[model samples]
Target: MARWRAAAFAAFLFLLLAVHCRGGKTGICYGRNADDLPSPDKVARLVQQQSIKYVRIYDTNIDVIRAFANTSVELMVGVPNADLLAFSQYQSNVDTWLKNSVLPYYPATAITHITVGAEITESPVNVSALVVPAMRNVLAALKKAGLHKKITISSTHSLGILSRSFPPSAGAFNSSYAHFLKPMLEFLVENQAPFMVDLYPYYAYQNSPSNVSLNYALFSPQSQGVIDPNTGLVYTNMFDAQVDSIFFALMALNFKTLKIMITETGWPNKGAAKETGATPDNAQTYNTNLIRHVVNDSGTPAKPGEEIDVYIFSLFNENRKPGIESERNWGLFSPDQSAIYSLDWTGRGNVDIMTGGNITGSNGTWCVASTNVSETALQNALNWACGPGDVDCSAIQPSQPCYQPDTLISHASYAFNMYYQKKGATDVACSFGGAGVRTTKDPSYDACFYLDSEKIINTNSTPPPAPSASSPSLPGLCFTLLLPVLPIVIASGFL
Candidate 1:
């Protein structure tokens, strides 16, 4: 009986751990090219308040790194493109930079990786020539400091590196960039770092809205997706197709062993007149749909079951960005620290757990209140979210207020399943929330929608009127916020 009791306890513990890690997990790239944003500490609180665990910054800013000290979040810092020229030429400078900037803020600040350069391969400048050397020097410096094994060194590349991507199987690298890429791949393989790529399907659609099907780009089920003639693989969405194109590109180079990580991917909420596809609704759909697909661990056709690690384009939109209007519109949050939209992490919505005085189902903007969260619930959530790493469970501090979400789910509408393949596990498990959205005045959304792994359960009933004038608009067809718990109103149409 005692043995049976022990086994039952072990099973219960395992179940708890599984629930913790499952669902639409997300990370943000906190690029501070703008000077008007909050301090690093304040930003850290904002990120924590959203319950985000991963952040990638443009540079190893000391204040930003230190501000995150003792927090469980994982950080990836970068070596800017302009600095690559010098970092490649001066070995001593590499060592000095590490000693001064990275080493002192090690385990304390949760610095997990260093990006040698941002989008080097796609840069028009001959700076691409310096990427290899810069990476080599940075790795050497880390090795010299005896930290090579602990911290990874990598670089982000724009999808512009691809010469052709239409039929994903026929994807190939730009021949002109081959000279620099071969050696870069070797270095990446030797160090076991990911070949990071920044993919933007929205750009493809925006550039050729007439040719691309809106449903295909937005992960809508009704669209008849494309099929690669060469590989005979059918892709239902552009995001998966983009990923497969990269996979095929790597396979062509015989670097099949290298892991692929998406360093950035997001939609723009606003854009210039020519950029008509950019809108808040479209951005919400693209990001929310992408998150559901990811947390579900839906790998590309070429690599099913592979957990694709990704970092969304940005945490906050920078007003100072110097590019087209769209350049500054990719943030999940706006400059004033308000969420650009809401995400439904928990499939069941309608509960009114609004955070920071943002009333449930209201249009008013509510920001995360603090930099740190309440230690107890968040840590419990974290322990449930991430498997036991080397994290010191007892040492965790409270995170600021996470977006308080309201759950209006009064009954089980349907058995929604979000399955993701565990990092090292062979078995696929139910992960992420995969609830479909319906916009109606209907208070009982359960009556209008049913959900599955690959399809949405359609009841086809026009939802009744919303409960109050304050109730958020009806959720969109394919997009709804899927992460931060804040109250979000929904609307339909492709941005």
Candidate 2:
């Protein structure tokens, strides 16, 4: 009996951990090419409040690195292009730099990746030759510090490196970069570091609107997907097509197993008249859908269910960046730290207008099952909500206060609202693949009260309401007792 209890307890713990597992993670880039941006400390706080887990910065400025210390946020620091030649010339240069900038606040700040340079291919100066040497020196320094395995070393590249990207299977790199890329690809494969590239579907669409549709670029549900004739695979979004193109490019070079990471990708919120696709709505739509696609493990047609880590191009709009109007407006937030528009980092597809750095919504909004959808769809959504969605459905079980209604809609409403509130009451949380709907009216009954965003602001503090007096409350007690056996039941398909 003792051994059985211990095994059951272990399974229960494993189940709890698995509930929160995600296929991919979304991170944001923190660029400070502006004079009016907030201090790093404030920026860190804002990032934490928004539940962001990873941040990439251009350089390892001490103040900025120190600001993220003792925080959950992970840092991906970089070596600027200007300093690449110096670092590449000598390992001692990288050693000294790491000793001062990294060794002090490494584990505390959670510094993960050290990107050597940004877009060396696009750099005005011909510093492409220095990239591999700089990377080697950085790797040697990390090995000396016993951090070679802990921290990854790579450089960011622009799409310009690829000579061909259309019909993804035919993707190939430019012949001119062969010498630089071969050695770099070898280093990446040996070190097991991902090939980091900065992809911008926004640019692809902007430069050639007739070739790339706005819906295809935005990951819109209504997109009439483009078909790659060579591979016979239909691509629903430009992002996936771009990713698969890079994958094929790596395969072309015999680096088939190399992982790809999106070091930067985002849409601009504003642009000149000619830049018609650059608007706030388009930006929000592209980012929101991108987050959903990534977090949900919707990989490209070429590589189904491949996990990719993507960092949104920018954190704030840099007033200092020189280019077209769209170049200066790629930030998710303004310089003042207010969100340009809300984003649901959880990938629940909820987006709303944010004001004064707080997510605002109707006070009484609640998610319930839609009457218009078919009952079968509702059931499927309900099953999803209770299963993978991680919603608690104990309140709707027999003998509970909410069990009196005993209807599919009532039970689903409880599960949907529970999920909606748990996901910060975002509109997309109520979507449930179009089987759920949001309403401003209260759906509470005699003792079965429904939760809204306002009521469950702090989910931890507010527990579910107790059962009514007439019921013995045996269901709740039984659930608590059976919690340890849940994993066993689920694994056996007996739940």
Candidate 3:
């Protein structure tokens, strides 16, 4: 028993050191686009605890930089799209940015890469034209400062940049961006920096659920594989296919030697209605398999035996990220810094994944505030459930079926469960700032249906359209609760 314990401890240390040495492919993207997340210091500690050595932030926030300082984690800092024009035009601005942002905490921070802009092709700002110029200027500035070789410089592109990618070999850049892409490719090759791209099989499968196999998108080996006729490469998963497509695209452009780094790739563990296969089951499968696949150092078919670096889409789900619900739900850890899923990262269970709140595909479900939860926390969550969280809370109004009992607890429970059910009955969704709890016991009262997973509103039963301002009281505000009294109380939480 003593020998086993000693061996386990040594193995754990080795896993951490291995991750630190290579900046493992199992990195996390730290997105701060939310309000309720823990501070960077806490999050950085969480990253180290997970033994995650690579981190990519969407922008160069010094707080985040300082959080990872002296922690031996490799970081890829970003330059927001808004700064692209300035970064492209002025060598002085790049110098100033590097001096202020990069030099101050660099070696201690393990700042490995500086991603100038993210998904430039997908940005509506036409900043795609400024990417290479910005990169060139930044590189020049880094070179002038003697940190050029130390910090690799590049920009992240989306898979949307590919015009043709299905066959993998036929992958080519969209003709429209030839002006921007060619020069950018040249810069990456000359500087020996890797080409970074955000790839999402979730988006691919979600967009074409009918034709694409859900199992294949989730990286399940049981999937009916697709064969690329040109290379005779049989792909059991969409991740390898998407990656090989870029390899083919780069080779077609004669930039065969450049490294490929996946800047962001993840399955959203939850998403809004109409998004098929976005669940904890699928997410855990994709991410777990991705980590194993990367750790095996088995490169994609096109780039055989080569290791590629990848950063997972996010560390925490950002509540304020705009777009579909999936945009806000691609987190590995809950906002409270709890693991939402488990992984045998070291093959020894050295990392204890949090399993307390992983409620999925259960026999039943109920969302209720814990007995001792704070009224203030419950009220804020109630506000979120109704307003931006988009719980259909109309039935909880004074005159409605669910409003028989006027107590805040009763009304909040109804709103919370509705939001919870709509969010795939996941315990994380029911987390109303830790005030909420998931229960198997039904809390349904008279004329009120406290839904469980079994009682899910049929997929065909669409939620009622949100009340419009022109006809109703307000545009974005929720019309649930005792309309007058509830909205006033909820507004104070925001204040």
User: Which has the greatest lDDT?
Assistant: 2
Model 1 Cα RMSD, 1 decimal: 16.3
> Which of the two candidates, 1 or 3, achieves a greater TM-score against the reference?
1
RMSD after CA superposition, every candidate:
16.3, 8.5, 22.7
For all candidates in order, the CA lDDT equals 0.65, 0.82, 0.75
What is the per-residue lDDT of model 2 for residues 1-495, given as tens digits with 9 covering 90 to 100?
655655665565455445434468799999998999999999999999999999999999999999999998999999999999999999899999999999999899999999998898899999889999999999999999999999999989998899999989988999998889999999999999999999999988998999888878887544566767776666667898899999999999899999999999999999999999998888988888788777766566677556789999789999999989998899999999888877888885444423213344435788898776557667877887787566778999999989978999899999999887766575545656455677879899999989876666555466657855332232321243355556776686432
Estimate the TM-score of every prediction.
Answer: 0.68, 0.72, 0.66
lDDT of 3 at 376: 60
Task: Please provide, for model 3 over 1-495, each residue's C-alpha lDDT reduced to its tens digit, 9 standing for 90 to 100.
Answer: 655544554454354445433423668888888999999999988888888888999787889899999999999899999999999898999889888987888788999898988898888788988888899899888888888888998889999899999989899889898998888888888888999999999998999988788867765533556767785655667888899999989999898888899999999988888886777767877777677567544456565436788888888888999999889999988899888776545311111113323234434757886555556656766887787555788888979989878877888888888876755554334545445666778898778878766666464267667744322223221223233343443354411
Residue 446, model 2, lDDT: 91
Off by over 4 Å in 2: 1-20, 350-495
Counting clashing residue pairs in each candidate, in order, gives 33, 0, 0
Off by over 4 Å in 3: 1-24, 347-495
Which ranking of candidates, highest lDDT first?
2, 3, 1
How well does candidate 3 score on lDDT at residue 443?
Answer: 90
Off by over 4 Å in 1: 1-25, 345-495
